[model samples]
Target: MPIEVKNELGKIQVMNEVIATLAGSAALECYGLVGMASRNQFKDGIAELLGRENLRRGVEVRHEKDRTEIDLYIIVSYGTKISVVAQNVQAKVKYVMNEVIGLQVNTVNIFVQGVRVA
Candidate 1:
């Protein structure tokens, strides 16, 4: 189901794919992030890097009860701190979703799929 937003003018519906794309874009802006990874890319302990066009495919958005959650599959640079990168991604995703799209993102779960050399 698409999320509904109400303003003084009218009510608007936003699809989950749109939200996922926005979240994925925000995530890619962070330092040390190589790119997004496919959600189902765990074959033989490897993750496939997704291109810019597959932003929505790399992210999973779940709206349950009164909470909104986003799961980001990512590949980080080999030399960067994994923990720091994940933290930044979480903060950025929430900020962009709330500020740009008017969507309140409650949780951002970052799954480090792989690490690649920059």
Candidate 2:
């Protein structure tokens, strides 16, 4: 379901996929992030890095009542502090969603799927 925003003009709707893509792009701009990881679990499932075109596949967006929650599946660079990377991703996503997109994001959940050496 698309999120509807009410303003003086009328109603504006934003799709969840669009929000996910924006979040993924914002997360990619953060340091120590290698790339996004696919959220699906296949046979012999490993965290496979998703291509730029599949940004929405790596992110899951949930809207409950008036709160929006974003879940990001990511791969971080090896030797980087995992906690710091996660925090940065959280902050960046929140900033882009709330400030840039004018969307109210309640939570950003980061799941480090893997660590890439390069």
Tens digit of per-residue lDDT, candidate 1, span 1-118: 8998788999989999999999999999999999999997677888989999998889999999889999999999999999999999999999999998788888999999999987
lDDT of 2 by residue, 10-115 (tens): 8989999999999999999999999999998533666888999999999999999999999999999999999999999999999998876788899999999888
**In candidate 2, which residue pairs get closer than 3 Å at backbone N, Cα or C atoms, i.e. clash?**
none
TM-score (C-alpha, index-matched) for candidate 1: 0.96
Error of 1 at 69 (Å): 0.3
Error of 2 at 84 (Å): 0.4
- Lowest lDDT 10-residue stretch of candidate 1: 40-49
Colliding residue pairs in candidate 1:
none
lDDT of 2 at 80: 97
